[model samples]
Target: MAASRMYLSAKRAAALDAELMSSGGFSLDQLMELAGLSCAQAVYKSHPPESKRNVLIIAGPGNNGGDGLVAARHLKLFGYNPIVYYPKRPNKDLYNRLVTQLSNLKVSFTDDIDMAITETDQILDAIFGFSFQPPIRDPFVHVIGLLELTKKPVTSVDIPSSWDVDSGPPKTGELGAGFVPDVLVSLTAPKPAAKFFKGTHFLGGRFVSKEIAEKWGFSLPNYPGVDQVVELPVDNEKL
Candidate 1:
């Protein structure tokens, strides 16, 4: 069930971007930061404290990857070594701050996806984020294959790569056959994409809603619903 009337949809998420640019006076970077920090808090709360555990963040080429990169930095600060894996070289917008942070921390980098996969204790699926529709192609399929092969504890930064945010898992094709996370660390509000699309058997697990988040005690300074980080705003434009 949609938590609130304000929940966001794919179309609405995009429109909100436009709305903010035109009226909200908020920059894309600021919004991205909000997403990143929120995601970090979700991660901290969902997983048990494991200073000895290693986390690998799979980054794509978009803003989603940028969110993962920010989380990686914070995860490191929280006492875990987070290694970020970029399938392709990240974009310039991401490179600006990402590179500086990595350089200062001198975080290890690897273009060879195979090598990075073997180095982590846990996996963070920052690969395709919300943009992924399903049936991953070529290189991505191969990378996700490695992740499945590892069978490590996996946590998606937002939504699992290519797993549709709504309509459950992709059933027709092999693009997103068996890609589910042990936990989904959502940002801002509950992603309809995350909630609706996560019921398939291939997903390999159940969802942990913001309500569950509250049970686990994930709270932040600027979070909308402190005790429970409610679902994303609904796509009212459609109604």
Candidate 2:
């Protein structure tokens, strides 16, 4: 259980992300699309539109945000109304393209977080990723703290926002890391922090080929058929 075969450290997760682009022959958009689709599928399976139709996706400024945008697009196509709240939008070309795609789909980008939180049935936390460091800053901190107060179910992308990738959630009762999302979607492979996550955990992003898995020293879970995401049986005690 302590091996890298199941749980990846922060360093290892970053290395695998780079290797996917470099040696794995995946372009940035390609990977983000795959990840985003998987995230959307996971959400559909976990919380169907009948259960929760309106979703509020809180995106950040990096690749994680790009993934959230992609998911929002897919979720809209899946018959769910998705409203995106991107506080710190990055000026990258890829991000611009993603936003344009979602905008074209008529997905709402709300400026009112409080209103969105009140009306939305669920929240997708994409405010941080594996490379995130401590001391959550600016609008992100305030937004994460807001999530902690919301009763709406949360589905975190990759790792929960503002959490340590390797060590899991903060123990000091930090406002930024206090919330435990109801659903967690682990991309590529489960990170070490996933062991601390108590929810309906899922393994999304089925883009990791067997070669890449072997190279990264993490065992990929069996994804049945053409499924984009697989629900992982998480036993925290064994983890």
Candidate 3:
């Protein structure tokens, strides 16, 4: 089947997520693992390991960050030197376990985002997901500013950091002030902001049920063969 072109608003996305967790026979951990693995696969597919093996993953304080940590583990196994810059980590046991897993893999963690950005070949923006709002908070505001200054290629996890899930970025004078990712791995379903993303976009999260998709009007792309991540066409005209 062809991929669905439907885009979800932030509220609808959250509702679908809740419904999936409650009745879709999948746990949060399972979805996160799949999403993270798909994201790693997307990065690996986009930038060959022979050329761009040094990846810097910027994690936030939510499940999105946990996904990045999981991606870090998989990236390490995939022969990529993934350095994590997690300024704020959540206190949940699930997140702690993810950190432990990364430590077990001996993945390097850095407090310096700028240094990591300077050294790495590619970046994974796992800082925020669909629930983020504007008026950017503390250290993240500073971090986003630094990212805006850099020219390195970035692959955002679910949604680009500081981007509104329902609408695109705030209509300030600077349209591209924040981190503009070269690739986007949309978990579960693509948010409305994705329509404006002019990059190689991929749909992750393979656990969503047919019922949920139909009910929520999710136009999902079909994953090819054994691949877990499928690239979607970007509307370059919108860029």
Candidate 4:
């Protein structure tokens, strides 16, 4: 499939962002919109024809969480039941806007990850945007534990919460290098962290892929006024 592709690492993802920003004539908000809408469409297509799932989106306070909220709103429009789990306090006005949109749409909200896990058929991880770092803390650690227990299908936006995008390794005390998301979605670039780090201790497989491109009906790279944008290398194995 056309979507069977790969992207760059978190640093590369950041580089792409910088490239776009330096090019000018576009704002980061626009990119966020594309990521969110694209994610929503991908999740919609992944479900079965008769599937009426209770989708749970776990979001942090960063842009990653924002993307998850965007997907939740779209999922609601697509007739699926979507609930958003916000683990941390939102720090940005844009994040506030997302919360407001969710409220306006009447999408259910929760601060408790455990509650969300119990209720959801599909889990979307928007927590910890990218660059999985050291020291797993309170709620995030709790959420990861819940993810381990649930074993439900999970789709991570950008990168999995516990996996370092560049190394694809788990954080401290994390047995593996990263979270084992059934599907890891990359917005504009592939995360190199999903590759490079391979060991018996590591998950040692593709942590990135573009399978959503075909499923979500993204025929062309999405830019506001452009027919097509730049094309990078496809790292299917990494995804």
TM-score of each: 0.73, 0.94, 0.93, 0.75
Instruction: Give the local distance difference test score of model 4.
Output: 0.63
Tell me the lDDT of model 3 at 238. Answer: 43
Q: Supply candidate 3's per-residue lDDT for 141.
A: 79
lDDT of each: 0.59, 0.86, 0.83, 0.63
Residue 179 miss distance in model 4 (angstroms):
3.2
| lDDT digits (tens) for residues 136-188 of candidate 2 | 88877778889888888999999999778988888776765668899998888
Q: Which candidate comes out best when scored by lDDT?
A: 2
Encode model 4's per-residue lDDT on 74-157: one tens digit a residue: 788878889988867666788888888889989998877776787678888788776556576777777877776676778777
lDDT of 2 at 74: 97
Flag regions of model 3 displaced more than 4 Å: 1-4, 174-178, 236-239
lDDT preference between candidates 1 and 3, better one:
3
User: Which candidate number maximizes TM-score?
Assistant: 2
User: What is the per-residue lDDT of model 1 for residues 1-239, given as tens digits with 9 covering 90 to 100?
Assistant: 23232334565545545655566576767666666655555556555447335778787777788877777776777767777777676548555777578658856666777877676777777777655665566678888777656767677765677666655455654555566666665554334555443321011102223453343333322334442233233223321
Off by over 4 Å in 4: 1-7, 171-178, 196-239
Model 3 gets an lDDT of 0.83
Model 1 worst lDDT run, 10 consecutive residues: 199-208
* Model 1: CA > 4 A from native: 1-7, 48-52, 133-135, 197-239
